[model samples]
Target chain A: MEENSKLSQFQPVKSIFEINREERMAPGHRACAGCGPMIAVRQILQSLDVKPVVISATGCVEVTTSTYPDSAWLVPWAHVAFENSAAVASGVEAAMHALKVRGELKEERPVIALAGDGGTFDIGLQALSGALERGHRMLYVCYDNEAYMNTGIQRSSATPFGAWTTTSPVGKEWPGKAEIKKDIMGIVVAHGTPYAATASISHWKDLMTKVRKAVSQNGPTFLHVYAPCNRGWRFEPKDTVEVAKRAVETRFFPLYEVENGRYRITVPVAKPRPLEDFLSLQGRFSHLLKPENLEVLKELKSIVEERWSKINAAASVQVQT
Target chain B: MAQFEPVQTRKSLLTGDEAVAHAVRQSSVDLVAAYPITPQTIIVERIADFAASGAFTGQFVPVESEHSAMSACIGGALAGARAFTATASQGLALMHEMLYAASGLRLPISMAIANRALNSPLNIHNDHTDVMGSIDSGWIQLFVENAEEAYDRVIQSFRIAEAVNLPVAINLDGFTLTHSTEPVEMLSDEVVRGFVGRPPKRDSLMDEAPKSFGLMSLPDSYQFFKDDQSRATTGSSVTISQVEGEYAKLSGREHGPLKIFRPGSKVMMVMLGSYAGTARTTARRMKNDGEQVGVISLGWLRPFPEKQFLDALEGVETLMIMDRSVSYGAPAGPLASDVMSLLYRYGIKRKVIAVTYGLGGRGFLEEDAMRLFRYAGKSGSSFESFFFYGGE
Candidate 1:
């Protein structure tokens, strides 16, 4: 009962658009018109109440917002390099404590590390694990666009099975990527983070609430946000959010949270929509719809179902014994 | 120079690593983010002891890798903290990428490099090869010949880095200086505090004013930043000297870009690190034996100290450059190549030989220095050349 009360302080934003809060990310940036990660960044920044020092990995968000002469960030932002955002945030958090020790700083600002999927799930995994294990008071947000969208869509570990990336292109003999997406949330939770979750741009309210709860934690927290890339996924730019929502509704990407080893389905889908509703909107998975790739489609569906069942079991309210 | 009594000190036996730890502890660093690599591990371990015993109040982050160590230092520096880290050889190689980032961002973070040989057969011993790998990384590199100089340079590095807004690397020879204990005079914490002076509040992420750092640059403005970095490095020589001058007032000890022993001798032998001490002793003995020999320790490798080097080269007709690292297919070793380049730039012609020696931490005996000095003394040929000195 007391554990439930610990999470009660986080007030969820009822709706993102209804709030008249000033945008933390300034306009006139270089992000694409329907950039999904940009929307996630905006909502994440808007959700924060306390001043935050944002550390970014080298990716689309860093490049687009922080061009040489101008920057779109209205808050303290740092982009060090690829594969070390978590490590950098660890330093910043440590510095905040040290500064307070020396009486140089009064109030310690929160630290939020942002990275793309490539930075989070692949080259950056070790650093992220170290940061989380060290229990630094910081929030790490991985905007999972499924591939290295900054350097033109190379397949990352976060890329779903059978998705056609530039590296995993469709060929006569070769299909698309053969492997399934890595279970990053499982990896993050294994580090015993105080809070870790999966969210999407479509569910801004849940995402914002998670951000608030993450910042309020005394130790490390993580958010694996499903950021759909329009150009990389080869979808109509305007349908980025719709495709993201389809991912959630189809059970392909579930919205959930793992708090102190306890799992809860924050947004449960009792009856998932057809998987086709999600895959059909993005060209990366269009090859899976063909009859020749019917087995691959079935395999993907079974995998998603198995994952959904597993998460549902984990988050079940019934007594396991 | 202003006249003042040197700060009171007590002498204690300390290794190069311990000397650096003492300096860092006294400098009031806000954060120390470092990974343990041999030859440099003692530094972090001693600082850890300081933190545990309450002698040092700074935060110590045992980072996962050298790359993360540097990355974290950058983060701490950006947050307006006095940041430090230490590494050697393979660790420095791993951190090669972020070294440029730290300097390019103009973060005044200081680092200590226990100079060691890079791995081929995976050896860990004293050599300049490790630091030479980063010769072009746009950092102010200071070389120390012994524990005392290591102690002095570590303190002076913070002043130089903060003054010029560039990172400083104080390189002490692995095992040779890092493990060898010497009586090092210590400065009080209050004295070091007065010297470095509160880290000089820079624009930080923690500041009220929001700012962006490490921005992406297109072709048009990329070179402008690089040019600025280049100028800042070349211009840091002034701050380097000025800091040493101030440190001299308090510590009564000062080191310059070049330490010349027996200046204006027709035959001059030059090197860096602990072996330079051997060369200096050899030169003194040979001078007493009626040989016109000179020895120079090139202390600062970066900023190259063009004018000072040229000045030291005056009336020195024969130059034997002792390098602990190979440049591999270049005309000479790394140090010899730089000196040769400096001479060529000025059209100063002389008999110059680049002799590579003490590689992979091979001990450089005083007799070895004597042999090099005697060899340079006998060489009658004019012009420049290169060779291995310790080969069978």
Candidate 2:
């Protein structure tokens, strides 16, 4: 993990502009300056060769980008309620199938549902599970920002352990959030889908590659991308990418994919960094650094290490098979 | 508008559920996403059977929940496909959030709501509570009196909904009409195809030109979007009547926003849905016995045909408003509230008696209607008129 994190820092920044010149997602939207999800969405859209019909759940992306009458999407997009994007995408895919069968639609168009962690891991889990289990030919992209930032930084199931949020504040006998983040990628993988992967905005190339690969697949696909929020995390806007990179280095958000029940770790970290390296950068975990809260840090590190071991074990078993 | 002569049709005895399925088959629907719910289950079951038998070529998606059903319908509609779904009380309530999403996006998805009473102790019988609860959902609502009207309205709903780009809810009395078999003269597939025609391809997600749908609106622009929705819903009145006129020519039956049994009468009873049929029968018997009683049945509820309702009530001495749904703690039921508001707005002063009846599928009889009309006719101002019938 230490080696990969160092290598990422020294590696030259690839010009995404030269790779794909067309901006399917237009500029001048309502996304906050230095918003991590916005950058991830642009890169993901750029990776798609076909113009996708984007179904967005009610969250930061939907509210910021398409604010009634004026929309930032240059591609065909829709924003339904908060927790039914996947279900809506299933409908769109069914319609496309019907239209294609009737010879009304000529070209193949991919249906993509974009949601936040609050929509994906929490409220929308049932709909997402149904869509994946039904094997709809669609891609569901969840921008896991750790908390519900759009709703004033409330703690969702995606909020990391010991992270402070509005609902899980750090004060009065409580250090921060008492629970670990929900394992949403594991749940998606369990559905036996054709493609399911985890990506982060800090690693744009990896994210774009996985997006392209997922979109090319035939059945249901899910891509959970790590997105850091500046306001919610109490970080400087410029440190969004840096915070996201540290998260991967510390094994907080591992980059991996489960394709056809086979596990593969995309960005392997040889020596994992300490969890403090990632948590110290954000004020959400500032309370954990106090002298009395050392046990909380230890607990968080142990959890991360345990998760890393599980992923590695799964990869080794896949290799043997 | 060009007119086609009424073509010979086949008569079939079917329940309201089967009638809806037949109408869906004839309308050339592109997709259906639905969840099974009581009183509304047979509708989807029949549609699924039609799909299995190769009678209907559309895609049938049996979703997990009513929320997903509406969500899927909205998705299909956004992709430029004619989509539909059906549900009853709880299922409709589960779909309450998506209901707003469908209309706010203006997806023109048609839904059949088997009107059943909501649960306190859990009742799966007939009432208007389900549809009445969604009065402000921005969808055009049509109440059918029987299986034949249910069949015809479902077909006309597609044209009205698609032409106006608004979701339409066709309400049929659960169990009363949904389970009771009745003879309906069905239009041929060719005539329905010509009547409904092909839904014009709109600027949708499938189109080459990229468009955004169901966008979020901030406070600065949210009200304007609502205003646009209001205009679309209200503006659909003309298209509704025109489509009904066209449908009347094809089916040899006329339907509209409201149906007035006796135009000019001293005493009138106003209601909606299948209960109007019983009221009409009682009114005929009363008229024969020298009492001037008439029935005005409301078809459209969301647009709330104020002009037509007021015109029908003109010169009537007393108006009795019948509602199947209660507005707890309020002075009257939902229908009575709207009726009184309309009467108050028009500066018309007359004795208006509001009564709530047939809740949770309790049978509403013609005797109850006659008794209520008689009591309202003779009672002075001190009468306790606001009450629920057949309730403890």
Candidate 3:
């Protein structure tokens, strides 16, 4: 496990410039500066070779693109209610099938569903589960910011343990968010999706490659992308990618994929940068300077490392994604 | 004595539910998220048989619950497949969340609701309560009266839904219409093809590339998405009538959002589903002896068709809103409340009375319809009236 953790981070280059400068996400939009989700989408769309239909929930991505008719999206797009993006997308995909079987749509054009942590982890899970179970050739990409950023950054199931959201504020022996982040990728994999991967913005190349593989490969593909938030995490605008990279280096967010049933690490940040090296840069962990606080944070990193090792092992337990 | 016009190329004997199933097959819907309940079982059963016999290539998910049924349907639809689903009564009620989701996304899809009264004490019979329960879920709802209308309406639903890029539900009474077999002029494959036509665009949510369909929404985006949904559904509200008009050009039978059977009567009785047919029967009896009674069959329920309804009811001195559902509390039953609300909004307040009929879907027979017309004749302000017809 130690040897695997130190493996060099995988980087795929051709996908980077392969993206069209004419972004599917148009230029004029309503997003905060250095928005991680939008950047993740940009990298993702770069990998897609076809004009895809985009379904988004009522989140930051949705608000930014569709604001009173002037959509920032260059592609055909729709924004459904918060909890049913998966369901709404399901209808669109079904319609396409009907059209194709009866000779309506050509055998091309990919469909993708983009959701936030709150939508995928909490409200929209049932619909997502059904979509994966149906085995429709669609990809579900969750831009995880760890909280409900669109709804004022409230704590969600995806919120990591000890993170301080408004609700999980740092106070009186309270360690902010109490529970560990829900391993949603596991739940998605349980649905028997053909492809599942955990990626982050720190590794844009890896993210894009996995996305391409996900959509091109048959059946349902799920890409859980860790996107850092400047506002949510109280980090500098320029540190979005830096913080993401630190996350992987400190073993907070590991890059891996579950194909069929086998697990493969796209980029193993196993050499392990000290947890302090990552936390010192973020305002969210400012209070962790106390010696005892540092101990707890170290414990958290240990948990993340242990979890990744098991995940890597479990990936090999299954095959044929 | 029978005379044949030979207007339709083909005909078939079937129930309303069977017609709906056949129409689903003819349309080649990709997935069916079905939650089978009584009287509505045949629709799913026939479709299931079709799938089993290698007839339909789509996935017909037999969901454990109505919520899951809609969930599966939505998933398949998102994957860029033609989808269909059926539900009734408690099952329809169970799919409450998904109903809003399906419409809010503005997906061009269709559903068949075997309308039945909801239960507390438990009853599985024909009524509008089930469909009425979710009438405001932003769907383009079309109520059908007979087997022929049911079949024709199912096909028309797809056109209406696809044209406006909205979800549509074809509502019909449970056993009253769904189980009652009747002669229906089933369209031949060629004529049906000519009328329905293929999907104009194949812009599926699913393509081979990395395109995302449905995504989670936040507060910053929920309202705008909802606004778009409302626009599409309301647009469909108007478009459905036009689709029906065009359908009439080819099928020779038509129904609209607000189909005014006989307007300009001093008194009018409104109804939906199979009860509309009975209400029309009762209206004719009442009008024969100059009773000044007429019937209005409501089809598209969501947009409410405010101006159209007000105009139809303007000449009438008295308006009786008869619904086959209960609202539990407040004044009028579901239909009556919506009508009165519309009238009040338009500042055209006439003598409007409300009454609830067919609780648990016992029956909305001709006598019940006559009784409602008679009640409309005798002007009263019993806004929360429940009629226990022919009780011991």
Candidate 4:
């Protein structure tokens, strides 16, 4: 009678419980301590319940997850050449479609491509654009760490202005990066894809939401996640999340999503903090602190404001439509 | 022993490119990703027509570049689909990086290369430069002499590649064979499909196996993996011969790694691709003129075919190797270099001469083969200087 009563007590809990909870990106990976891209990758992968075939470019994520004879990915993954991840994903998607048509495959699988900023914004832009224009059913995620972190912190087009990268070092004739960051989100939107979004590692809930939304779409979808680099940005390893938070609070990286050619800013900062609060913590922008380089800081701030205003105008038009 | 008789096949007149298209259609290729390049464009064009007409049940991806084409093939193959593509000289060069990735991942993708000259003076003509340049890219290369061989090898390539778990490249001379129409004994779709069978059920990314491919390898493990790949390629000779034998049983046309004519001759010429046809005709004429001459055409460029080459060259006093592409600063051209290496390894010393000709679509005729063979047969002639035919 006591054993029956105990079994009756456990029945209610079992009714409310869900089984088979597993993490797709496993632990024991080679990512550094407090790696922001690793955090973004984890959160984004967790957003998908279905197993995805991951195609990665040659970057920190690929190098860390897949070392020779060992793999950290629990899901199926492939790392092709650096500049052809999207193209490879396009092929995989086509193959899946063909298999389904031929009745060789029964279950549908999502294809996800993970690339670094150097791959997405610079070298792999053409391939990515081709995939997007062709309407491949896949999701491409760019973990934007600002610079080429895998190749030792070289400057990429995604690197912001007034930042010191290996190739954009402060010298007598030059002051850090002379050009502003390339508007990669705008370029992706111009492809007229079904979905495109920008998220940051600090906003885990918002990033995962965007990931789920992107995956739900049928056509090509892109999500650009702002990932802070602790080593490359010259910050304490423990302050990785703190750095990423500051980047969002300062309006340096905005949170927005574009669905079906309509824009919506998800995280709108009512009062953005000064950009200096984010820059002063990272040694990459220490040169901008000099009084002689005050103009560069002003230029950076103006570019940020100009971008925010343009996004706001676009969102308003979308709302009106 | 009974003499082998050719099978009665359904004959059709087709170009090399058309033959390749027919083979792709006949084989159960699930996907084709390709970019249009000169001399190889007709292949994809015909494939597109077939796809549009609902004759071919596959996905034809018109990629933006050859790099993407090969990249897509890698993806499709990783997804456990039979993938195929075709390209020419510049297109092949553009796909150089992905070529290693395909072979390294063991994708078993088949590519048809319409062999053309590489650029610098931008010529779209027949040469071995494209395929020769990629000899070290870890693909099993088969050079065809005509449309019939091109069709047969394309079907045979899929079987060999999937059996050995490697990529195969079927190379035919650009304008010479790709544009010229010839009578080809084509196999029926059912026969070809039965011969190719289904793709081997390997662990692919599309399956539920959750496997990871193309991982980064450190110095400690990189060499071992590369050595394993080398072993797979070197050990594929038996698989190639077996598949060719099986294909012959179905098609009644025998295609071997090496084709020898007039064996055990005093003077012999070795060549690859369509030039072999002209060389064979020249050698037969020389034999009729009471001159002991012969020709050996190499169908398999990779795996070197050392034993077959040695067996064909036995008792030959002099060898004239016809190369359409130069090795540039080496003692001989690419084919001759491998032949010379084999001779040195086996301690067989023979008078060897390399005649590089037909580059940039310059014609290589029967007269040229006769001249080279006669030059090789004459005594007291130094083989020090490599002969460059039809050049200023």
**How many clashes does each candidate structure show, in the order listed?**
0, 3, 46, 0
> lDDT tens string, model 4, A13-91?
1221221257888889999998989988887777666788899999999999999888999889999989999999988
Candidate 4 true-interface contact recovery: 0.83
lDDT of 1 at B316: 93
Q: Lowest summed-lDDT stretch of 10 residues in model 4 chain B?
A: B1-10
DockQ for all models: 0.82, 0.69, 0.18, 0.69
Residue B263 in candidate 2 has what lDDT?
76
A40-110 in candidate 1: lDDT tens per residue? Answer: 99989888666689999999999999998999999999999999999999999899889887788887887
Q: What fnat does each of the candidate structures reach?
A: 0.79, 0.86, 0.30, 0.83
CA lDDT of each candidate? Answer: 0.89, 0.86, 0.74, 0.87
Best by lDDT: 1
Per-residue lDDT for B150 in model 3?
86
The 10 consecutive residues of candidate 1 chain B with the worst lDDT sum are B1-10
Give the alpha carbon lDDT tens digit for every residue of B286-310 in model 4: 8889988898999998877888888
Against the true structure, candidate 1 has what lDDT? 0.89
* Candidate 3 structure quality by residue, lDDT tens digits, B281-377: 7778877867777888777677677768877975787777777777877677888888887877877777877766666666667777676677667
Q: Model 2, B1-392: lDDT tens per residue?
A: 22222224588888998899888988889899999999999899888888887778788988989999999999999998999999999999999999998898888898999999898879998888887788899999999998999999999989988899899999999988999999999989888888887788787889888988877767898888889989888888889989999899888898788999877777778889998888889889888989878888999998889889888977787788888888888888898888888878989887777878888888778888788768777866621346557522
Per-model i-RMS: 0.6, 0.9, 5.7, 0.8
Q: What's candidate 4's DockQ score?
A: 0.69
Least accurate 10 contiguous residues by lDDT in model 2 chain A? A1-10
The residue-by-residue lDDT of candidate 1 on B33-143, one tens digit each, is: 999999999999888888887777789999899999999999999999999999999999999999999999999999999999998978898888999999899999999
